[model samples]
Target chain A: MSAKSVQMVLYPDTHLDQAAETIHRLRQHGIDDRDISVISGVPYSDKILGRPMSWTRIGLIGLAGAVVGFAIATSLNFGTPYLYPIRVGGQPFFPIPTSIVVTFELTMLGLLISTFLGVFIETITPSYGPKGYSPKVSDGHIGVLFSCPTEKMDEVKKGLEDLKPEWVKNPEAKL
Target chain B: MAAETKTLSATHSASQEGEDLRQEHLMHDPKPREEMNGMVMEAMQTTSKKYWIALAIFGLGVLILLFGFWGNQIITGMGVTGKRRPVFWALYITTFVFWIGISHAGTFVSAILRVFKAEFRRPFTRAAELMTTFGLAAGALFPLIHLGRVWTFYWMIPYPNARWLWPNFRSPLVWDFLAITTYLLSSTIYLYLPLIPDLAMARDRSTGWRHSIYKLLALNWRGTEAEWHRLRKAINIFAFAIIPVMFSVHTIVSWDFAVSQTVGWHSTIFGPYFIIGAILSGVSAVVMILFIIQSTMKNMKYFIRLEVFDSLGKLVLIFSMAWAYFFFNEYLLHWYGGYQAVRDLLTFHAQGPTAWVWYTMLICNVAIPWLTLWNRKIRRTPLAMFIITTLVNVGMFAERYTIIPLTLGEQRFPFDWGAYSPRLTDISIVIGTFCLFIFLYLLASRLIPLIPVWEVQEGQMAHSTRKLGKGKVTSVAELE
Candidate 1:
């Protein structure tokens, strides 16, 4: 991509409705949906962001973590035997009922930790150093970032500027 | 400059003729950010000779009761505790249930209200989460301490050793360990995730070792669009998932007793009973902490208003009723069953050595919140609510004590039945745990932004004034 065409930043009002309208305007243009991004101080859903559905595999990752946790718990509950053997309360060598607790605990631990890591993996967070950012965005401003062809840069900026963004700027710095 | 200052004071006195309505609120009397930060830092840093003296007292208490008393108990072999043959589980188990119940308020405040988007919960979520972490920390210790040998705690885990000793999975105690451990981990993670943004804020505003500490904890969070998006998605998922986890934890804790074949402990209704009791106690603790924070901390009164206490009071009333219903259900079922051991435990609870504790528990847990919280005036009054909430906790603690050791006094075999008296060490450790909770909370209050500023701002954005025919009304929108 050419330098001018690679990125654009638009500052919309904090109002939700206005932000939505801005998204509608961009989609009306030929900008590919994936190229658009919305950022705000608070968390907003995709529907609010005016984006297509995100295919986040957070749930699946959590499920995988749970499986791993369950296996470990089960092995610990049952496998310690060949190495050494101990029996208490005269119940059984391997107890399914008690093992369930350990399994559940491990499953939850796995799910929570994996979900946390999943957020990092999905978003690539903790990004320090110079990047395309504005601290005012955190003070109740909606920022919309998009990409388009260099020839269409003027057209895209004008099109977005017509929507009355607070400020429209070219790529200032790369994140 | 002198002329302008004189004019400002002249205007200030003219405007401030009335009761100086500003002092009524901590939040309304807002200070500059730098000033507020300095106040918080001062509170953290300004430990006095008196504070150290008190800490030393507590430390000595810990030494005497925990080490000395526990040593005596071990050398004497569980005799220091009133745990006789039939009532093997005594004061320690009672304290376990009590502390676990106290832990529930944090999850209820942070996760459930967060899912529903309660604005009032924004400021105190971290405070509540601290309660959860500290409560669980204290609660977990009881089980270990009750194990007596204290060293062989590993036997609780499933393993094959020369002894071939696998812990009984059917036992509720084993279930409790897993459930508590899971909840502790989940709650800790949940607590930390939201604190990242606040830690970054702290980092931005700090210097020296504090800056480094916050920086490391902030994890280089720069509040990027992608980062916010991911954090939002993760939080929403967690909010929904954690509610069930919190519910499961208390239910499992309840089952520890309910699953047993013993009379008072064997009822099917005990599961819901324990859960309601937990929420009742938990909500009261939240109210008490809110009161303290609002009164003591700078910029807190504005965020925690009478509106919050009003909502919490209502919850306390509702949960109080639910607890009463469960209590009646369990009592009636056992009464109707006419089982000898069940009736004996019930009678023993009412008329035995701990009879005063039994009656007081009923009055405090059921009667006070039920009667007084119903009135809006009493509910909104901070002092009144605080007293009622403290009583609720006292009542909840008594209920656990009666259930654990007191009921155990009435056993099937009279020869094995005995009362439980906590050794001196038990008392010390319990105090230490309380001190530990307060110490951690005091440290956290200064270090972390107890009020989630971003969440509060989000809530404020969702709220606005709308005009109707005659007056203005507050309204909220579904921003998400």
Candidate 2:
């Protein structure tokens, strides 16, 4: 991204195989996967178009939240009943089954809410900044954006031209 | 050997052998992405006179009923409703449960179907998500209406008090408060997460107020590879995670009654029974809304088709039977126990003043669906589905009524037994909530693009027809 990228192509068709071929040509022109960024209206996994898989920590964060929630729910359930200690003729002081219900709810709440926030954190949303962006991507065009040395710009253009994209343009910064 | 092989092959049935899968399913029959965006935008922008007239009517109802009734309730305290003696929780609770049941359909349909890669779910998922949010909104109002001091709603928030009293974890009501809050948050976030891409799409081709709004909501989403990857992962988490939250919310709500020492309410089956019934009503409500949107809104015909109705109808039937089985399970257990008071409660539900509602429940929820939904023709017709689904909702409402007020009216002491009926304020609040629900939905239809265009396009990309031995069949490529 730092080498000054241009959005190389905007393909009108949603042919998965052809999209893969376009990426293959970029690689043949010596573009690193890190230098290439795929953009489209739909969330298509990279592996589908022969790109490297990207990892996300949302699930792990969810698991961590579940643990934290369980701990809090446990403390509240175990401590609160005894603290209040209202005498119900024969009911036990700390009802574990009842506590389990509260614990379960909190655990799920923690997991779900954390994963939701994880999306915003991972995507750095509400950014509203200038970076690489094209509105045609939302109209279902797959914009292949990549950066290269100034000398290789012509070679990159030639590679993209062979892919027969509907349009090509320099991507305005959307950071 | 060739002749024998041909004869064996002929014995195999290819149901979609000649039918065009594209014509049958929305996924297979996709227009271009641009065309889809145009159609969706048109549906949002093309509200008719009737739409406004309905909105105005509902809006008036909201003003009169909400403020008027709730104000009366606030002034008069809890006695305004039929919550007398043993029948302490009646109409509001019943309706609350009914709304919760309705909310289940959205999460069940959207999250579960996404997990299974059901392509037909692409278009109507937003509609169902809206139902979940609005239904919960309606459901949340009841506890407020039920509160003795309506203004003191914050006491449930677990903030440290002057007396240092906090919300009790042991109380099932607290569990419900926690569960409902969690569910509302999760479902709203769930609704908004997938909506980002569509908001971005809307942002692209709009001007004026719409453009400004979409731009804000779209979160500058240019659909970068990292962003899409993160979005997919997050949605996957939501899909799996929200299902359990959905189940917990209703199951915890069920516990509000189930854990009580009351006769019929103290059953182990209530958790699952309530969940099944919720999904049933939710699915029916979804079908009804889909039918309305398809018939009334512009270009909805492209997104919502008979196939959607048929698939939904099948779910309604399956859950209807599930509800019946659970009803029987709960019934047989009580009947076999032969407890005199429990028997009296059952008799009251079946033969008392409100016995007709119970009978109607049986007919609407069980009998009608069992009889008609099995027929593909009845299931496929949008009008037929609309009617049957409307009945299903009626039956489910009656089912909740039978559980709450009818049983509440019954007493183990016999002398304390009294019949419960809603007063005018109670009735008004219920009507107001119903109007409010529809009003929110009607307004939302204009604000948000109901169709998930990106998901639909992605589904279209995944779907193609491949030639088989004797015919072409629908084949879905796992694009993920």
Candidate 3:
């Protein structure tokens, strides 16, 4: 028979020091960092929690959007005027001063819109499927979610109970 | 024994002072996260009979005054409005600029303050951001209302057409369209980004239809480290990005007049002058709204403390001085140039039939803020700040009134000059926009978490009181 791993949760009150200690102890208990996730009502920096920093591509996406916006503005201002040329008061069809305004506005528009959409893309948002979650997290509690081999569940629970969490149980059953 | 008694007395006095400081500042006063969340949720959920009555009245005002008058204007044509000949842009343009200026309060208070790490901004940033989105909604309507034929407003969009006619990118009007559109979208997104975690909190606690709404709006936020990390990064990007965009928006709006050939309208100083004026009115509007929120909402007194009013009053006072400088610079240059038409316009502004507006602008924007805000007691007093901010906005409106119709009343040739006043439709539409803004705000106050609970909690976490040389002092940690 194959050994299966079970997801467990530990609820701690809103104390960064305590949460940090619990996470440190968990790491010492043979749990890899990738196998554990922390949820809380307030954001804690990775340094505060002694965890690895997470990276995001939102800035890159915003820059890409800016380039696209610049392209559109250039085409509209520089290229379209040639198609239906309407010369006014001996001014050039593509006036640099006026073109700058349109370019700046459009470029910003693209950057903002893409940055907003980037949040959704990066987070896989509007995801409605059931996942390992705890309502206590929103109530300003820190929830530590981790997986352990079914055979080792007893040992992990005993180890976590020493930390004095509110509860330690399988998240699937409680959530 | 005598020395021990003295030391105990001094220690007791220091602790008392520390306690008093906590009472005065929201950051120093820390509440449990659950309690703070409950207070915010209660504030959102609790509504009174007066609230509903006010909402209904504002809603009716919007329907009758805004939409009804606007619809009548559209059907009856532009003749019904006061726009005629040289004074073609009148009250509609003035109010349009006023509301756009009002929208700046949100970005200035929320984004700029966030970037600078102003601790007092924690509770009210959401309120100011809401003002940005709704103020833009109210302000963006005027250009369409001024369009005469509102249905064909899409012609301003840059798209391929059957006749190969594209909007003139060279025209300031087109820039106004682009700038306002970008600002509206950008501010709305900025408002929504900080709101997601709060929405998730609401979702977890709510039931029925409210739960469904928050669930969708929350975007299934789980408060995971990765999600929070990305959200913070995105919010930081927006914080820095939106400031220049905010400045650009009003600068473009100013160009609408500055680029014109009108003697009083053309000036290199208009851009910075308009920007300073906008910030003055914007910050004052924020103070006025904060007073309203603190007074009306439940449990808001705990969050919108007097310290916030004191800090914002300082900003208003500084901006007023800056505005005075620009006002003088613009006036002195025009007076020094000695151009006959420009001099006549300046004289007409002071001695015209509507000279009351010019005086009101001076007294309210300059005299009142200068005299009153310097007193810390008055600045800290909510009611006094409210009255002063309200007058400042009144003064700002008068300033715009002077610039638009009053200035347009003057010309190089006396024969071609004429005075302009808003007719009934124009007045109704202006009042309706105010009603529209209030109505949207009333609804939004109930629907969303007006006070950002997480941000307040985060701030409280970073703040602590420690003893420094036998005196207690509040210290803040750079948590981010």
Which candidate's TM-score is highest? 3
Per-residue lDDT of candidate 2, residues B64-86 (tens digit) = 99768888878878777767887
lDDT per residue as tens, model 3, B1-480: 999999999888877897899899888888877788889899999999999999999999999999999999999998998888778889999999999999998999999999999989999999999998999999999999998999989989998689897888888999999999999999999999999999988988888999999989998788888889889988998999999999999999999999998888899989889989999999999999899999999999999999999999999999999999999999999999999999988888898778889999999999999999999999999999999999999999999999988888787888889989789999999999999999999999999999888898889888988878866778899877
- The TM-score between candidate 2 and the true structure equals 0.94
Model 1 lDDT at residue B188: 83
* Residue pairs in candidate 3 whose N, alpha carbon or C atoms collide under 3 angstroms: none
How far off is residue B17 in model 3, in Å?
A: 1.5
Considering the two chains of model 3, state its CAPRI-style docking category.
medium
Worst 10 residues of 3 chain B by lDDT: B465-474
User: Model 1: residues >4 Å from true position, as ranges?
Assistant: A1-39, A46-55, A70-105, A123-130, A134-175, B1-79, B158-168
| Candidate 2 ranges beyond 4 A from true positions | A1-5, A15-18, A80-91, A125-131, B1-20
Q: Find the 10 residues in a row with the least total lDDT in model 2 chain A.
A: A122-131
Of candidates 3 and 2, the better by TM-score: 3
Among these predictions, the greatest DockQ belongs to 3
Considering the two chains of model 1, state its CAPRI-style docking category. acceptable
Candidate 3 vs. true structure, TM-score: 0.97
Could you give candidate 3's per-residue lDDT for residues A1-175 as a string of tens digits? 4364646454545556767877787688877777677888889889988988887889999999889999999998998888887777978766899999999999998898899889989877433222467777777888776665567767766876766776544465232
lDDT string for model 1 (A1-175, tens) is 5543445354533456766776787678777766666655566767776677655667777778778887877776667543466556876777777667667777776777788878656645334222444444544566666666678777766876756676545434422
